[model samples]
Target: DHQGKGTTEPGVMHQEPYGSLLPFGLHKGYALATMCEILGGALSGGRTTHDETLVSCHDAIFNCMTTIIVNPEAFDAPAMQQEAEAFLSWVKRSPQSGDAPIQIPGEWEENNRLEREREGIPLDTNSWEKICQAALQAGMPEEELAAFRALAQ
Candidate 1:
């Protein structure tokens, strides 16, 4: 949909792509995105990126987000643990049809965490360099950062 190399305009069917940013699943994605912005911005009394140029967002502003925390101990701790275990057991009992066993949402995350805890997390060279840069900015000594660099490998 271009007349030249630099002329990357939208196709005739997709007019003004940047101005009319269409969602992947049409109305469904639009609704979800709208609701998410409403909850994070409107509910928190914070300004949203909507109706503002992208450049304006870099100005002094705090993007709001809501996080819900539940203390299991405050509720029926033992019963909740038992029920959770039972549900996991039931789900795991299902016959595996894929290369990997069926896993609930956070199961792989938990397993990954345990693995990382045992045999430290690996970081790529570029990401490790960025971390070193940030740590230096945060007052970490260059000498101390060398220790972290060793572990990053």
Candidate 2:
């Protein structure tokens, strides 16, 4: 049974329209998930969600990520580098309505990560209080918290 089926459980609840036409056509999503099962299960010789009672039970969750590491010197190195640079430059120069500049996939995340490390991560008061409470519950002394805060600086 799909988890989307209505239940009176206390935790988070999610329900979906069961008819032929679903919101955003969830049938499409189901079809895609079915395709993933075929690729990750049958093709890869792995177990899928349907094969187990618990959703987490699986031989291995196959990652479809494909990475190509090119030895530029083997090919036309300079030309390949020039072409990639030109393409990136064109993408960055493309018109946008937003105030900030357009960024490629990892660029924004890398920048944010660097900025947060340099300037300590800003947590809301409630979240900071919750963290302190958790630390206290875990038997973390005030001196230890102060030491951790000093390390952050």
Q: Which RMSD values do the candidates have, in order? A: 8.3, 8.1
What is the lDDT of every predicted structure here? 0.70, 0.65
Candidate 1, residue 1: Cα displacement in angstroms equals 21
lDDT tens digits by residue: candidate 1, 1-153:
223233334552244222334555765788877776677777877866554633565332357886668888887567898898899999888987778988898889999999999998876778877888999999999899998777665
State the lDDT of candidate 2 residue by residue for 1-153, as single tens digits. 134564454333222221122334555677876776677666665555443523453223455432447677887566887898899999999999979999988999999999998896888878877887899899999999888767644
Query: TM-scores of the models, in the given order?
Result: 0.43, 0.50
- lDDT of model 1, residue 98: 75
